[model samples]
Target: MRSPADPARLATLLEHRAHRLRRDASAQAEQAAQRDREAQTLRSAADKRLQAAQLGEEHGLDRQRLFERLRGVAIARAHVLECELRAGHLQEQAGDAREQEQQLRHAAAGNHSRARRLQAVGAHIDQKHRQARLRRQERQIQEEYTCR
Candidate 1:
Protein backbone atom coordinates (compact mmCIF):
# COMPACT_ATOMS: atom_id res chain seq x y z
CA MET A 1 0.00 0.00 0.00
CA ARG A 2 1.18 3.46 -0.80
CA SER A 3 1.88 5.70 2.16
CA PRO A 4 0.19 9.06 2.62
CA ALA A 5 3.45 10.73 1.72
CA ASP A 6 3.71 8.82 -1.53
CA PRO A 7 4.46 10.87 -4.64
CA ALA A 8 1.90 8.94 -6.66
CA ARG A 9 -0.89 10.01 -4.36
CA LEU A 10 0.09 13.65 -4.57
CA ALA A 11 0.29 13.38 -8.34
CA THR A 12 -3.21 11.94 -8.45
CA LEU A 13 -4.57 14.86 -6.48
CA LEU A 14 -2.83 17.31 -8.76
CA GLU A 15 -4.20 15.58 -11.84
CA HIS A 16 -7.72 15.89 -10.53
CA ARG A 17 -7.22 19.60 -10.02
CA ALA A 18 -5.86 19.95 -13.53
CA HIS A 19 -8.89 18.23 -14.98
CA ARG A 20 -11.24 20.55 -13.13
CA LEU A 21 -9.34 23.59 -14.34
CA ARG A 22 -9.46 22.38 -17.92
CA ARG A 23 -13.20 21.89 -17.67
CA ASP A 24 -13.66 25.39 -16.38
CA ALA A 25 -11.60 26.80 -19.21
CA SER A 26 -13.70 24.95 -21.72
CA ALA A 27 -16.88 26.37 -20.23
CA GLN A 28 -15.48 29.89 -20.44
CA ALA A 29 -14.52 29.44 -24.07
CA GLU A 30 -18.05 28.29 -24.85
CA GLN A 31 -19.47 31.34 -23.11
CA ALA A 32 -17.23 33.60 -25.17
CA ALA A 33 -18.45 32.02 -28.36
CA GLN A 34 -22.04 32.51 -27.31
CA ARG A 35 -21.42 36.20 -26.66
CA ASP A 36 -19.76 36.68 -30.02
CA ARG A 37 -22.76 35.14 -31.75
CA GLU A 38 -25.14 37.42 -29.88
CA ALA A 39 -23.16 40.48 -30.94
CA GLN A 40 -23.26 39.44 -34.56
CA THR A 41 -26.99 38.78 -34.42
CA LEU A 42 -27.64 42.19 -32.87
CA ARG A 43 -25.57 43.96 -35.52
CA SER A 44 -27.44 42.19 -38.29
CA ALA A 45 -30.83 43.16 -36.88
CA ALA A 46 -29.74 46.79 -36.59
CA ASP A 47 -28.61 46.85 -40.22
CA LYS A 48 -31.90 45.41 -41.37
CA ARG A 49 -33.81 48.07 -39.45
CA LEU A 50 -31.71 50.86 -40.93
CA GLN A 51 -32.27 49.53 -44.42
CA ALA A 52 -36.02 49.43 -43.88
CA ALA A 53 -36.03 53.02 -42.63
CA GLN A 54 -34.14 54.21 -45.71
CA LEU A 55 -36.52 52.40 -48.03
CA GLY A 56 -39.49 54.01 -46.36
CA GLU A 57 -37.95 57.48 -46.92
CA GLU A 58 -37.44 56.72 -50.63
CA HIS A 59 -41.20 56.40 -51.16
CA GLY A 60 -43.03 59.64 -52.16
CA LEU A 61 -45.28 60.89 -49.34
CA ASP A 62 -47.34 63.84 -48.02
CA ARG A 63 -45.67 65.99 -45.33
CA GLN A 64 -47.82 64.48 -42.60
CA ARG A 65 -46.91 60.95 -43.72
CA LEU A 66 -43.26 61.92 -43.92
CA PHE A 67 -43.30 63.14 -40.34
CA GLU A 68 -44.91 59.90 -39.23
CA ARG A 69 -42.33 57.89 -41.14
CA LEU A 70 -39.53 59.79 -39.37
CA ARG A 71 -41.04 58.95 -36.01
CA GLY A 72 -41.21 55.27 -36.83
CA VAL A 73 -37.60 55.32 -38.05
CA ALA A 74 -36.47 57.00 -34.87
CA ILE A 75 -38.06 54.27 -32.72
CA ALA A 76 -36.43 51.56 -34.83
CA ARG A 77 -33.08 53.31 -34.48
CA ALA A 78 -33.42 53.40 -30.70
CA HIS A 79 -34.24 49.72 -30.56
CA VAL A 80 -31.23 48.90 -32.71
CA LEU A 81 -28.96 50.97 -30.49
CA GLU A 82 -30.28 49.27 -27.36
CA CYS A 83 -29.66 45.81 -28.81
CA GLU A 84 -26.13 46.80 -29.78
CA LEU A 85 -25.35 48.03 -26.25
CA ARG A 86 -26.64 44.82 -24.67
CA ALA A 87 -24.56 42.76 -27.07
CA GLY A 88 -21.47 44.77 -26.18
CA HIS A 89 -22.00 44.11 -22.49
CA LEU A 90 -22.35 40.38 -23.08
CA GLN A 91 -19.13 40.38 -25.10
CA GLU A 92 -17.28 42.02 -22.21
CA GLN A 93 -18.62 39.46 -19.76
CA ALA A 94 -17.38 36.71 -22.01
CA GLY A 95 -13.95 38.26 -22.10
CA ASP A 96 -13.82 38.25 -18.32
CA ALA A 97 -14.78 34.59 -18.20
CA ARG A 98 -12.01 33.71 -20.61
CA GLU A 99 -9.45 35.50 -18.47
CA GLN A 100 -10.58 33.60 -15.38
CA GLU A 101 -10.23 30.33 -17.25
CA GLN A 102 -6.66 31.17 -18.18
CA GLN A 103 -5.76 31.80 -14.56
CA LEU A 104 -7.18 28.48 -13.50
CA ARG A 105 -5.21 26.68 -16.17
CA HIS A 106 -1.98 28.18 -14.87
CA ALA A 107 -2.73 27.09 -11.33
CA ALA A 108 -3.40 23.54 -12.44
CA ALA A 109 -0.09 23.42 -14.25
CA GLY A 110 1.76 24.55 -11.16
CA ASN A 111 0.12 21.84 -9.10
CA HIS A 112 1.18 19.23 -11.62
CA SER A 113 4.78 20.37 -11.41
CA ARG A 114 4.72 20.21 -7.64
CA ALA A 115 3.36 16.68 -7.73
CA ARG A 116 6.18 15.59 -10.02
CA ARG A 117 8.77 17.06 -7.70
CA LEU A 118 7.27 15.25 -4.73
CA GLN A 119 7.37 11.95 -6.57
CA ALA A 120 11.03 12.41 -7.34
CA VAL A 121 11.78 13.03 -3.69
CA GLY A 122 9.92 9.87 -2.67
CA ALA A 123 11.90 7.80 -5.19
CA HIS A 124 15.16 9.21 -3.93
CA ILE A 125 14.31 8.30 -0.35
CA ASP A 126 13.37 4.75 -1.30
CA GLN A 127 16.66 4.25 -3.12
CA LYS A 128 18.69 5.38 -0.12
CA HIS A 129 16.84 2.96 2.20
CA ARG A 130 17.51 0.05 -0.15
CA GLN A 131 21.23 0.82 -0.30
CA ALA A 132 21.46 0.97 3.49
CA ARG A 133 19.80 -2.42 3.84
CA LEU A 134 22.19 -4.01 1.31
CA ARG A 135 25.25 -2.58 3.03
CA ARG A 136 24.15 -3.98 6.39
CA GLN A 137 23.65 -7.47 4.94
CA GLU A 138 27.12 -7.39 3.35
CA ARG A 139 28.75 -6.35 6.61
CA GLN A 140 27.01 -9.12 8.54
CA ILE A 141 28.23 -11.77 6.08
CA GLN A 142 31.81 -10.54 6.31
CA GLU A 143 31.80 -10.62 10.12
CA GLU A 144 30.40 -14.19 10.24
CA TYR A 145 32.95 -15.49 7.70
CA THR A 146 35.82 -13.88 9.55
CA CYS A 147 34.73 -15.50 12.82
CA ARG A 148 34.44 -18.94 11.23
Candidate 2:
Protein backbone atom coordinates (compact mmCIF):
# COMPACT_ATOMS: atom_id res chain seq x y z
CA MET A 1 0.00 0.00 0.00
CA ARG A 2 0.96 3.64 -0.06
CA SER A 3 1.79 3.42 3.62
CA PRO A 4 4.41 0.70 3.73
CA ALA A 5 4.57 1.17 7.47
CA ASP A 6 0.91 0.19 7.86
CA PRO A 7 -0.05 -3.01 9.75
CA ALA A 8 -2.61 -4.06 7.14
CA ARG A 9 -0.19 -6.35 5.36
CA LEU A 10 0.19 -8.50 8.43
CA ALA A 11 -3.57 -8.65 8.77
CA THR A 12 -4.00 -9.74 5.19
CA LEU A 13 -1.55 -12.57 5.64
CA LEU A 14 -3.35 -13.78 8.74
CA GLU A 15 -6.69 -13.62 6.96
CA HIS A 16 -5.35 -15.62 4.08
CA ARG A 17 -4.02 -18.29 6.40
CA ALA A 18 -7.32 -18.55 8.23
CA HIS A 19 -9.21 -18.84 4.98
CA ARG A 20 -6.97 -21.63 3.70
CA LEU A 21 -7.30 -23.61 6.92
CA ARG A 22 -11.08 -23.43 6.78
CA ARG A 23 -11.18 -24.36 3.15
CA ASP A 24 -8.96 -27.35 3.68
CA ALA A 25 -10.84 -28.45 6.75
CA SER A 26 -14.16 -28.32 4.95
CA ALA A 27 -12.73 -30.23 2.05
CA GLN A 28 -11.50 -32.98 4.32
CA ALA A 29 -14.85 -33.24 6.04
CA GLU A 30 -16.70 -33.42 2.76
CA GLN A 31 -14.44 -36.12 1.44
CA ALA A 32 -14.92 -38.14 4.58
CA ALA A 33 -18.69 -37.84 4.28
CA GLN A 34 -18.57 -38.86 0.66
CA ARG A 35 -16.55 -41.95 1.43
CA ASP A 36 -18.97 -42.95 4.16
CA ARG A 37 -21.87 -42.52 1.81
CA GLU A 38 -20.15 -44.61 -0.83
CA ALA A 39 -19.54 -47.43 1.61
CA GLN A 40 -23.13 -47.39 2.76
CA THR A 41 -24.39 -47.46 -0.79
CA LEU A 42 -22.20 -50.40 -1.60
CA ARG A 43 -23.46 -52.31 1.41
CA SER A 44 -27.07 -51.58 0.57
CA ALA A 45 -26.61 -52.75 -2.97
CA ALA A 46 -24.98 -55.97 -1.87
CA ASP A 47 -27.72 -56.60 0.68
CA LYS A 48 -30.37 -56.13 -1.96
CA ARG A 49 -28.61 -58.56 -4.26
CA LEU A 50 -28.33 -61.15 -1.53
CA GLN A 51 -31.96 -60.77 -0.62
CA ALA A 52 -33.05 -61.18 -4.23
CA ALA A 53 -30.87 -64.24 -4.63
CA GLN A 54 -32.33 -65.84 -1.51
CA LEU A 55 -35.83 -65.28 -2.80
CA GLY A 56 -35.02 -66.67 -6.24
CA GLU A 57 -33.28 -69.75 -4.86
CA GLU A 58 -36.64 -71.15 -3.77
CA HIS A 59 -37.55 -71.58 -7.48
CA GLY A 60 -34.55 -73.30 -9.09
CA LEU A 61 -30.75 -73.98 -9.24
CA ASP A 62 -29.81 -70.44 -8.15
CA ARG A 63 -28.30 -71.40 -4.82
CA GLN A 64 -24.74 -72.25 -5.84
CA ARG A 65 -24.01 -69.26 -7.99
CA LEU A 66 -25.90 -67.03 -5.65
CA PHE A 67 -23.86 -68.25 -2.75
CA GLU A 68 -20.64 -67.58 -4.64
CA ARG A 69 -21.80 -64.15 -5.65
CA LEU A 70 -22.84 -63.42 -2.07
CA ARG A 71 -19.49 -64.52 -0.83
CA GLY A 72 -17.72 -62.19 -3.19
CA VAL A 73 -20.07 -59.37 -2.25
CA ALA A 74 -19.35 -59.99 1.41
CA ILE A 75 -15.64 -59.74 0.75
CA ALA A 76 -16.12 -56.58 -1.28
CA ARG A 77 -18.23 -55.09 1.46
CA ALA A 78 -15.54 -55.79 4.03
CA HIS A 79 -12.92 -54.19 1.84
CA VAL A 80 -15.13 -51.18 1.17
CA LEU A 81 -15.83 -50.77 4.88
CA GLU A 82 -12.13 -50.87 5.57
CA CYS A 83 -11.51 -48.27 2.89
CA GLU A 84 -14.24 -46.07 4.35
CA LEU A 85 -12.75 -46.29 7.80
CA ARG A 86 -9.32 -45.46 6.44
CA ALA A 87 -10.71 -42.50 4.58
CA GLY A 88 -12.40 -41.28 7.71
CA HIS A 89 -9.16 -41.58 9.64
CA LEU A 90 -7.27 -39.74 6.94
CA GLN A 91 -9.83 -36.98 6.96
CA GLU A 92 -9.53 -36.68 10.70
CA GLN A 93 -5.78 -36.45 10.34
CA ALA A 94 -6.14 -33.78 7.74
CA GLY A 95 -8.41 -31.80 10.02
CA ASP A 96 -5.90 -32.10 12.85
CA ALA A 97 -3.05 -30.99 10.61
CA ARG A 98 -5.04 -28.05 9.36
CA GLU A 99 -5.80 -27.01 12.91
CA GLN A 100 -2.12 -27.22 13.80
CA GLU A 101 -1.18 -25.20 10.75
CA GLN A 102 -3.76 -22.58 11.61
CA GLN A 103 -2.37 -22.27 15.08
CA LEU A 104 1.16 -21.95 13.75
CA ARG A 105 0.17 -19.34 11.20
CA HIS A 106 -1.68 -17.31 13.78
CA ALA A 107 1.32 -17.42 16.08
CA ALA A 108 3.61 -16.42 13.25
CA ALA A 109 1.41 -13.49 12.37
CA GLY A 110 1.34 -12.30 15.94
CA ASN A 111 5.08 -12.65 16.18
CA HIS A 112 5.51 -10.76 12.93
CA SER A 113 3.27 -7.95 14.13
CA ARG A 114 5.18 -7.74 17.38
CA ALA A 115 8.49 -7.65 15.55
CA ARG A 116 7.29 -4.81 13.36
CA ARG A 117 6.06 -2.87 16.37
CA LEU A 118 9.44 -3.28 18.02
CA GLN A 119 11.20 -2.10 14.89
CA ALA A 120 8.94 0.91 14.62
CA VAL A 121 9.58 1.77 18.26
CA GLY A 122 13.31 1.41 17.73
CA ALA A 123 13.19 3.71 14.72
CA HIS A 124 11.21 6.28 16.65
CA ILE A 125 13.71 6.18 19.48
CA ASP A 126 16.60 6.61 17.05
CA GLN A 127 14.84 9.57 15.44
CA LYS A 128 14.36 11.19 18.83
CA HIS A 129 18.03 10.70 19.66
CA ARG A 130 19.04 12.35 16.40
CA GLN A 131 16.74 15.30 17.05
CA ALA A 132 18.15 15.69 20.55
CA ARG A 133 21.69 15.76 19.19
CA LEU A 134 20.70 18.36 16.59
CA ARG A 135 19.15 20.57 19.27
CA ARG A 136 22.29 20.35 21.41
CA GLN A 137 24.47 21.37 18.43
CA GLU A 138 22.21 24.29 17.66
CA ARG A 139 22.37 25.46 21.27
CA GLN A 140 26.22 25.26 21.26
CA ILE A 141 26.38 27.30 18.07
CA GLN A 142 24.06 29.95 19.48
CA GLU A 143 26.12 30.20 22.68
CA GLU A 144 29.40 30.67 20.76
CA TYR A 145 27.82 33.34 18.50
CA THR A 146 26.47 35.18 21.53
CA CYS A 147 29.85 35.11 23.26
CA ARG A 148 31.56 36.52 20.12
Candidate 3:
Protein backbone atom coordinates (compact mmCIF):
# COMPACT_ATOMS: atom_id res chain seq x y z
CA MET A 1 0.00 0.00 0.00
CA ARG A 2 1.20 3.46 -0.92
CA SER A 3 1.15 6.30 1.59
CA PRO A 4 -1.42 8.97 0.82
CA ALA A 5 1.00 11.72 1.82
CA ASP A 6 3.67 10.69 -0.71
CA PRO A 7 4.65 13.83 -2.57
CA ALA A 8 6.12 12.02 -5.57
CA ARG A 9 2.94 10.07 -6.18
CA LEU A 10 0.80 13.19 -5.75
CA ALA A 11 3.01 15.10 -8.17
CA THR A 12 2.72 12.37 -10.80
CA LEU A 13 -1.06 12.35 -10.47
CA LEU A 14 -1.27 16.11 -10.83
CA GLU A 15 1.00 16.03 -13.86
CA HIS A 16 -1.20 13.44 -15.55
CA ARG A 17 -4.31 15.48 -14.79
CA ALA A 18 -2.71 18.55 -16.27
CA HIS A 19 -1.75 16.69 -19.42
CA ARG A 20 -5.30 15.46 -19.90
CA LEU A 21 -6.67 18.94 -19.41
CA ARG A 22 -4.24 20.35 -21.96
CA ARG A 23 -5.23 17.73 -24.50
CA ASP A 24 -8.90 18.54 -23.95
CA ALA A 25 -8.18 22.23 -24.39
CA SER A 26 -6.37 21.61 -27.66
CA ALA A 27 -9.29 19.60 -29.00
CA GLN A 28 -11.72 22.34 -28.01
CA ALA A 29 -9.59 24.94 -29.79
CA GLU A 30 -9.60 22.88 -32.95
CA GLN A 31 -13.37 22.58 -32.80
CA ALA A 32 -13.66 26.34 -32.43
CA ALA A 33 -11.41 26.90 -35.42
CA GLN A 34 -13.43 24.49 -37.56
CA ARG A 35 -16.63 26.29 -36.65
CA ASP A 36 -15.09 29.59 -37.60
CA ARG A 37 -14.05 28.25 -40.98
CA GLU A 38 -17.52 26.88 -41.63
CA ALA A 39 -19.07 30.21 -40.71
CA GLN A 40 -16.75 32.03 -43.08
CA THR A 41 -17.68 29.73 -45.95
CA LEU A 42 -21.35 30.39 -45.33
CA ARG A 43 -20.78 34.13 -45.28
CA SER A 44 -18.85 33.89 -48.51
CA ALA A 45 -21.70 32.04 -50.21
CA ALA A 46 -24.20 34.63 -48.98
CA ASP A 47 -22.06 37.45 -50.34
CA LYS A 48 -21.79 35.82 -53.73
CA ARG A 49 -25.56 35.37 -53.92
CA LEU A 50 -26.14 39.04 -52.92
CA GLN A 51 -23.70 40.20 -55.60
CA ALA A 52 -25.39 38.15 -58.27
CA ALA A 53 -28.76 39.62 -57.34
CA GLN A 54 -27.38 43.15 -57.57
CA LEU A 55 -25.90 42.44 -60.98
CA GLY A 56 -29.21 41.06 -62.23
CA GLU A 57 -31.03 44.23 -61.03
CA GLU A 58 -28.73 46.54 -63.00
CA HIS A 59 -29.77 44.99 -66.32
CA GLY A 60 -32.84 46.65 -67.97
CA LEU A 61 -35.47 44.21 -69.24
CA ASP A 62 -39.19 44.07 -70.33
CA ARG A 63 -41.95 44.10 -67.65
CA GLN A 64 -42.43 40.35 -67.67
CA ARG A 65 -38.70 39.71 -67.55
CA LEU A 66 -38.28 42.34 -64.84
CA PHE A 67 -40.96 40.66 -62.69
CA GLU A 68 -39.27 37.30 -63.14
CA ARG A 69 -35.90 38.80 -62.25
CA LEU A 70 -37.42 40.45 -59.16
CA ARG A 71 -38.83 37.12 -58.02
CA GLY A 72 -35.45 35.50 -58.48
CA VAL A 73 -33.80 38.33 -56.53
CA ALA A 74 -36.30 37.91 -53.69
CA ILE A 75 -35.55 34.20 -53.51
CA ALA A 76 -31.84 34.88 -53.58
CA ARG A 77 -32.23 37.44 -50.78
CA ALA A 78 -34.14 34.93 -48.66
CA HIS A 79 -31.39 32.38 -49.20
CA VAL A 80 -28.81 34.96 -48.23
CA LEU A 81 -30.72 35.78 -45.03
CA GLU A 82 -30.88 32.10 -44.15
CA CYS A 83 -27.18 31.72 -44.73
CA GLU A 84 -26.45 34.73 -42.55
CA LEU A 85 -28.53 33.28 -39.71
CA ARG A 86 -26.76 29.94 -39.93
CA ALA A 87 -23.40 31.66 -40.00
CA GLY A 88 -24.36 33.68 -36.95
CA HIS A 89 -25.27 30.51 -35.08
CA LEU A 90 -21.98 28.91 -35.99
CA GLN A 91 -20.11 32.00 -34.81
CA GLU A 92 -21.89 31.83 -31.48
CA GLN A 93 -20.98 28.18 -31.05
CA ALA A 94 -17.37 28.92 -31.94
CA GLY A 95 -17.27 31.67 -29.32
CA ASP A 96 -18.56 29.26 -26.71
CA ALA A 97 -15.97 26.64 -27.64
CA ARG A 98 -13.20 29.24 -27.42
CA GLU A 99 -14.37 30.22 -23.94
CA GLN A 100 -14.34 26.58 -22.85
CA GLU A 101 -10.83 26.10 -24.22
CA GLN A 102 -9.55 29.10 -22.29
CA GLN A 103 -11.04 27.76 -19.07
CA LEU A 104 -9.45 24.36 -19.59
CA ARG A 105 -6.08 25.96 -20.31
CA HIS A 106 -6.29 27.94 -17.09
CA ALA A 107 -7.12 24.83 -15.08
CA ALA A 108 -4.24 22.91 -16.68
CA ALA A 109 -1.78 25.67 -15.80
CA GLY A 110 -2.88 25.62 -12.17
CA ASN A 111 -2.46 21.85 -11.97
CA HIS A 112 0.99 22.05 -13.55
CA SER A 113 2.09 24.64 -10.98
CA ARG A 114 0.85 22.44 -8.14
CA ALA A 115 2.73 19.44 -9.56
CA ARG A 116 5.96 21.42 -9.80
CA ARG A 117 5.66 22.58 -6.20
CA LEU A 118 5.04 19.03 -5.00
CA GLN A 119 8.08 17.78 -6.95
CA ALA A 120 10.25 20.46 -5.38
CA VAL A 121 9.10 19.50 -1.91
CA GLY A 122 9.77 15.81 -2.60
CA ALA A 123 13.29 16.60 -3.85
CA HIS A 124 14.01 18.65 -0.73
CA ILE A 125 12.85 15.81 1.51
CA ASP A 126 15.02 13.28 -0.35
CA GLN A 127 18.05 15.55 -0.03
CA LYS A 128 17.50 15.88 3.71
CA HIS A 129 17.20 12.09 4.10
CA ARG A 130 20.43 11.52 2.16
CA GLN A 131 22.32 14.02 4.34
CA ALA A 132 21.08 12.35 7.49
CA ARG A 133 22.17 8.95 6.23
CA LEU A 134 25.65 10.29 5.42
CA ARG A 135 25.97 11.82 8.88
CA ARG A 136 25.02 8.50 10.51
CA GLN A 137 27.60 6.63 8.44
CA GLU A 138 30.32 9.16 9.33
CA ARG A 139 29.51 8.86 13.08
CA GLN A 140 29.69 5.06 12.92
CA ILE A 141 33.10 5.24 11.18
CA GLN A 142 34.40 7.64 13.85
CA GLU A 143 33.24 5.38 16.69
CA GLU A 144 34.91 2.32 15.09
CA TYR A 145 38.18 4.23 14.68
CA THR A 146 38.07 5.32 18.35
CA CYS A 147 37.44 1.71 19.46
CA ARG A 148 40.53 0.54 17.54
Candidate 4:
Protein backbone atom coordinates (compact mmCIF):
# COMPACT_ATOMS: atom_id res chain seq x y z
CA MET A 1 0.00 0.00 0.00
CA ARG A 2 3.01 2.28 0.28
CA SER A 3 3.94 4.81 -2.42
CA PRO A 4 7.04 4.05 -4.51
CA ALA A 5 9.06 6.70 -2.70
CA ASP A 6 8.06 5.64 0.78
CA PRO A 7 10.32 2.63 0.93
CA ALA A 8 13.22 4.70 -0.39
CA ARG A 9 12.75 7.25 2.36
CA LEU A 10 12.43 4.53 4.95
CA ALA A 11 15.58 2.91 3.62
CA THR A 12 17.48 6.14 3.94
CA LEU A 13 16.39 6.54 7.54
CA LEU A 14 17.29 2.97 8.37
CA GLU A 15 20.68 3.33 6.75
CA HIS A 16 21.36 6.41 8.82
CA ARG A 17 20.44 4.58 11.99
CA ALA A 18 22.68 1.68 10.97
CA HIS A 19 25.57 4.04 10.40
CA ARG A 20 25.09 5.56 13.83
CA LEU A 21 25.00 2.14 15.45
CA ARG A 22 28.21 1.16 13.70
CA ARG A 23 29.90 4.33 14.90
CA ASP A 24 28.77 3.65 18.45
CA ALA A 25 29.97 0.08 18.19
CA SER A 26 33.38 1.24 17.01
CA ALA A 27 33.66 3.67 19.91
CA GLN A 28 32.59 1.01 22.38
CA ALA A 29 35.12 -1.45 20.98
CA GLU A 30 37.91 1.09 21.32
CA GLN A 31 36.95 1.77 24.91
CA ALA A 32 36.81 -1.95 25.64
CA ALA A 33 40.26 -2.42 24.16
CA GLN A 34 41.65 0.33 26.34
CA ARG A 35 40.02 -1.16 29.41
CA ASP A 36 41.46 -4.58 28.55
CA ARG A 37 44.92 -3.08 28.20
CA GLU A 38 44.59 -1.49 31.59
CA ALA A 39 43.39 -4.77 33.08
CA GLN A 40 46.42 -6.57 31.64
CA THR A 41 48.76 -3.97 33.08
CA LEU A 42 47.15 -4.30 36.48
CA ARG A 43 47.31 -8.09 36.31
CA SER A 44 51.01 -8.00 35.44
CA ALA A 45 51.80 -5.70 38.30
CA ALA A 46 49.75 -7.80 40.72
CA ASP A 47 51.49 -11.00 39.59
CA LYS A 48 54.91 -9.47 40.24
CA ARG A 49 53.94 -8.29 43.69
CA LEU A 50 52.39 -11.65 44.52
CA GLN A 51 55.54 -13.45 43.34
CA ALA A 52 57.71 -11.21 45.48
CA ALA A 53 55.47 -11.79 48.48
CA GLN A 54 55.75 -15.53 48.00
CA LEU A 55 59.53 -15.35 47.78
CA GLY A 56 59.65 -13.25 50.91
CA GLU A 57 57.46 -15.70 52.74
CA GLU A 58 59.82 -18.54 51.81
CA HIS A 59 62.71 -16.57 53.23
CA GLY A 60 60.87 -16.16 56.60
CA LEU A 61 61.29 -12.37 56.46
CA ASP A 62 60.53 -10.16 59.49
CA ARG A 63 56.92 -10.58 60.56
CA GLN A 64 55.94 -6.93 60.14
CA ARG A 65 57.64 -6.57 56.73
CA LEU A 66 56.17 -9.88 55.60
CA PHE A 67 52.66 -8.80 56.60
CA GLU A 68 53.15 -5.47 54.82
CA ARG A 69 54.28 -7.18 51.61
CA LEU A 70 51.36 -9.58 51.86
CA ARG A 71 48.98 -6.70 52.32
CA GLY A 72 50.48 -4.89 49.30
CA VAL A 73 50.05 -8.05 47.24
CA ALA A 74 46.42 -8.36 48.34
CA ILE A 75 45.66 -4.74 47.45
CA ALA A 76 47.31 -5.13 44.05
CA ARG A 77 45.38 -8.34 43.39
CA ALA A 78 42.12 -6.60 44.28
CA HIS A 79 42.91 -3.77 41.90
CA VAL A 80 43.66 -6.29 39.17
CA LEU A 81 40.35 -8.03 39.77
CA GLU A 82 38.49 -4.76 39.68
CA CYS A 83 40.18 -3.79 36.44
CA GLU A 84 39.36 -7.17 34.92
CA LEU A 85 35.72 -6.78 35.90
CA ARG A 86 35.54 -3.32 34.35
CA ALA A 87 37.16 -4.64 31.17
CA GLY A 88 34.63 -7.46 30.96
CA HIS A 89 31.75 -5.03 31.39
CA LEU A 90 33.13 -2.78 28.67
CA GLN A 91 33.60 -5.76 26.36
CA GLU A 92 30.00 -6.77 26.91
CA GLN A 93 28.83 -3.26 26.11
CA ALA A 94 30.85 -3.32 22.90
CA GLY A 95 29.34 -6.66 21.94
CA ASP A 96 25.85 -5.31 22.53
CA ALA A 97 26.55 -2.26 20.39
CA ARG A 98 27.88 -4.46 17.59
CA GLU A 99 24.77 -6.62 17.76
CA GLN A 100 22.55 -3.58 17.48
CA GLU A 101 24.53 -2.38 14.48
CA GLN A 102 24.01 -5.71 12.75
CA GLN A 103 20.28 -5.56 13.39
CA LEU A 104 20.08 -2.05 11.96
CA ARG A 105 22.04 -3.08 8.91
CA HIS A 106 19.66 -5.95 8.26
CA ALA A 107 16.66 -3.67 8.57
CA ALA A 108 18.24 -1.19 6.18
CA ALA A 109 18.89 -3.95 3.66
CA GLY A 110 15.27 -5.05 3.83
CA ASN A 111 14.06 -1.49 3.32
CA HIS A 112 16.35 -1.07 0.31
CA SER A 113 15.05 -4.30 -1.19
CA ARG A 114 11.48 -3.18 -0.70
CA ALA A 115 12.28 0.18 -2.30
CA ARG A 116 13.66 -1.54 -5.39
CA ARG A 117 10.56 -3.70 -5.74
CA LEU A 118 8.28 -0.71 -5.33
CA GLN A 119 10.19 1.20 -8.00
CA ALA A 120 9.90 -1.75 -10.37
CA VAL A 121 6.15 -1.96 -9.84
CA GLY A 122 5.79 1.79 -10.36
CA ALA A 123 7.70 1.57 -13.64
CA HIS A 124 5.45 -1.25 -14.86
CA ILE A 125 2.36 0.80 -14.03
CA ASP A 126 3.70 3.80 -15.94
CA GLN A 127 4.52 1.67 -18.96
CA LYS A 128 0.98 0.30 -19.00
CA HIS A 129 -0.45 3.81 -18.85
CA ARG A 130 1.73 4.93 -21.78
CA GLN A 131 0.66 1.96 -23.89
CA ALA A 132 -2.99 2.63 -23.18
CA ARG A 133 -2.59 6.25 -24.27
CA LEU A 134 -0.95 5.17 -27.57
CA ARG A 135 -3.80 2.73 -28.25
CA ARG A 136 -6.40 5.48 -27.71
CA GLN A 137 -4.57 7.83 -30.11
CA GLU A 138 -4.45 5.14 -32.80
CA ARG A 139 -8.14 4.46 -32.40
CA GLN A 140 -8.96 8.19 -32.77
CA ILE A 141 -6.81 8.47 -35.94
CA GLN A 142 -8.47 5.39 -37.50
CA GLU A 143 -11.93 6.75 -36.77
CA GLU A 144 -11.08 10.10 -38.33
CA TYR A 145 -9.78 8.43 -41.49
CA THR A 146 -12.86 6.22 -41.80
CA CYS A 147 -15.20 9.21 -41.35
CA ARG A 148 -13.31 11.24 -43.93
Best by TM-score: 3
Off by over 4 Å in 4: 1-60, 144-148
Clash number for model 1? 0
- lDDT score of residue 79 within candidate 1: 82
Question: Candidate 3 residues 41-120, lDDT tens each?
Answer: 99999889887876343556888988877887888899999999999999999999999999999999999999999999
Residue 58, model 2: lDDT of 41
Instruction: Identify the runs in model 1 with alpha carbons over 4 angstroms from their true place.
Output: 55-59, 136-148
- C-alpha lDDT (0 to 100) for residue 74 of candidate 2: 73
Residue 114 of model 2 has an lDDT of 66
Query: Runs in model 3 with CA error above 4 Å?
Result: 1-4, 55-64, 142-148
User: What local lDDT does model 4 show for residue 72?
Assistant: 78
At residue 130, what lDDT does model 1 achieve? 88
Task: Estimate the lDDT of model 1.
Answer: 0.83
Sorted on lDDT, best first, the list reads 3, 1, 4, 2
Taking all chains together, the TM-score of candidate 2 against the true structure is 0.56
Question: For residues 35-97, what per-residue lDDT tens digits would candidate 1 score against the true structure?
Answer: 889888988998898778863425578889888888888988898889889888988888898
The alpha-carbon lDDT assigned to residue 77 of candidate 4 equals 72
After superposition of all CA atoms, the RMSD between model 4 and the true structure is 4.6
TM-scores of all candidate predictions against the true structure: 0.80, 0.56, 0.84, 0.62
Per-residue error for 125 in candidate 1, Å, reads 2.3
- Residue 24 lDDT (model 1): 83
